[model samples]
Target: MINLKEIKNDLPAGIVVFLVAVPLCLGIAMASGAPLFSGIIAGIVGGIVVTLISGSQLGVSGPAAGLAVIVLQAIQGLGSYEVFLSAVVLAGAIQLALGFLKAGSIGYYFPTSVIKGMLSGIGVIIILKQIPHAFGYDSNYEGDVHFVQPSGGTTFSELFNAFNYITPGAILISGLSLAILIFWDQVLTKKHKVFQVIQGPLVVVVLGIVLNVVFANGFPQFALAASQLVELPVASSLNGFVQQFTLPDFSRVFTYDVLFLAGTIAIVASLETLLCLEATDKLDPYKRISPANKELVAQGVGNMVSGMIGGLPLTQVIVRSSANIQSGGRTKLSALIHGLLILCCVLLVPQVLNMIPLSSLAAILIVVGYKLAKPALFLGMYRSGWNQFLPFVVTVIAIVLTDLLTGIGIGMAVAIVNILRNNYKVSHYLYKDEKSITRDKYRMLLAEQISFLNKGNILQTLRKVPENVDLEIDLSKSAYIDPDVRELIEDFKETAVTKNINLTIKEIDRTTAPTDEKALL
Candidate 1:
């Protein structure tokens, strides 16, 4: 439900998110080699359409930096933007099918360590990527997550390069903007409700603009060029805005290339959405869990609408969603309002928005990054134990070295190995007990849900049992023993009889595990 009471908070948050999202949408589109306006169309659809159907309160969906490379290649390979849009439409259909099939449970498999690592890695990336922009180097595009830059330098190299091409105006604006945001977030917000009503991001943006105008008059050497400021494309009239919408060419929708691209899109987009949904829910101050399947449905519908109007493929983006949460968005209304604000700004005041400095936006993102990758998070995880801490560290390192999905894959691999190692040693308990049939007898108790992985230990223990002695094998506590283990036990029954051993098998509840009775049957 949309709560009118929180609109005061949501309205201010929406404006802040809109301020951050504009250049991102444009920069992502530019990086993908698509029309810049297409990114805005996606931001609009993702915010308004997705939020209405989505169960996630704080998650904001839009064009993701993760998808930018795929989009860049797919458009060229598919021949044109119109045909790529057709593939995006089909991908949405595939996502809708996945939601109905309950594929959203994939979110559950991401271990807590890996999830924390993913967020921390992304946070580190935000600070690293934006440092260049903050210091007046705009060679790289906004929202670029890759280590190898599309602008021709590595992540660290770009930072080093910033020293040579420093624009004094951008540095001054970003530094002051950072300080103002810190003061607003730390001091002013605690002291009064009025500060909460008057948001820091809004103030930083206004201050940035005023400073740039002052630089132009008083210190021309320190003034920023047009490239260092917000660059929204202005439309001449309503007709021009209407002309921005481009429909997909349905004729090529059935082609093999389009179908293949659609399948790829469906898989990548769904994975990214699930990752962000989990991360966003963790960031929610209320600790509310979003319905993953419902979120998938929302994203599918959003993508379908975006493609119908010629926008880039969309996903649940962590950057904007984190920005929303840190800026104090309480409900889905903040996402809706952010979309409306973007739509209104693009239509009404593109010229005015173009005056906002990118340095100010960079400062805002830098702060969001700090909140995500705090030092305390590392200390807390380290104290949790090595099993949890190792995977978390590996995931963070992997994400910093590679991209989001690649890093997650590495972390999950490490986590799964830890589980397998633990499972290998503790499959069953074999010991002499008072409940044994006689003084010479031994008892073998199976563990619950034993898999083929546990067969080695079971085999070694069974071989050590003396043939002339009585033995009792208990299945009462076990559930769903693997067929291989069952077959081994059956072979042992014959061996026991040959060696004149008295063997007793205890029955388990038939309803809970009928498979255990297959050895006797």
Candidate 2:
């Protein structure tokens, strides 16, 4: 299934994603208060191991920003990084069990409105979070996506605070990088095949490094602080590099606290993975759907391996996945190649990676963010009617105000309310022919699926049947009828007789029909 022609595209895309992912892995590890190398290890496992087993061609997995708070607290709560690794292993096992149990179908229940809201909300968050980095205020961790900043400021407050601490060199580099990215996307890519092969982000990264070097040597006033640059852990020798990999302390794996932590990680990580998978599938240009259960299994295995080697928890990350798709990755090969590239870089040229400035990467993400939450997207959603637009806007706002899961829960709640409201009014249709007006004859057709939510509506409809009217209730097309609904219909049979209304039922199961008036009483 690995096409050679696709590799031609995947190769460059892999490198582009690799460029975007390096600092993120480091920054997330830093944010989580774990060894910096663990993030890279997780990235490597996600790219190489997960992609091999995963059914998603476009979804790239890695250390998730959303899990950073949990990871930070888990490590602190569990006493040490080694013990946390054991919990991670257990989490992976739990995910594997979930996959086998066919729990992935839970993702299908997410309405399209909520999914779009997630994507747009994340997009807005990315732009907001990256602005400070783009301006060279590295007070916050690079890959942290939460609305509340670790520095005790909100996302917008951080942006305002960043203005006072701007580094001229970072701004200049980011400005040029953004311009080049725009040029590459809008101009060079359309005009030249060579530009397509060599991505704009790559060029921006190279230019950023060169610019920073120039600033450091000749223009000290314009130079970025150490915090504004990528900080990959450097190993002087092969032994030092090998020493970076840590193994989990399986002795504590079965401890009650560790087991509890594992279950928490498993549920949160799985939910994030499923949400990201849905968003990524929507972003896929080919419109290919990834198998959610297969993805859970792949993530489980990836996390197991990552934990064995002292890596952070893994999930299908939207940022990296979106970068891969935007850069033209056509298969899982791009993810695999990116993983291998990260492994190779950390071993061979981490010094070189550390030279790339954070501003350039911020610019890349800013562009990616724009693509996800465009003004046109909001306008288009607004045109879809209030039912759709309310959930979409509510989701975006909730995500911006809270975390990913909470925002999604809010959006889903709104969507469910909309469904219930529509269902309440339209559970059944009452039709009467003009010729039957004198007789008050009515034909009632039940909805395909009727639940307790329809009970009140059905009762209202039944009560409106005028005295001496003829009524027919049809259930031929209904696949399911709630117990309450069935009971109401059966009770109505007796009421119909009292009112002198002729009642006939079609396709109603005889077992659910009243056998005697005593049964109804």
Identify the candidate with maximal lDDT. Answer: 2
TM-score of each: 0.93, 0.95
Point out where model 2 deviates above 4 Å. Answer: 508-521
- lDDT agreement with native, every candidate: 0.91, 0.91
Off by over 4 Å in 1: 432-442, 463-471, 492-503, 511-521
Which residue pairs in candidate 2 have backbone atoms (N, alpha carbon, C) closer than 3 angstroms, thus clashing? none
How much does candidate 1 score in TM-score?
0.93
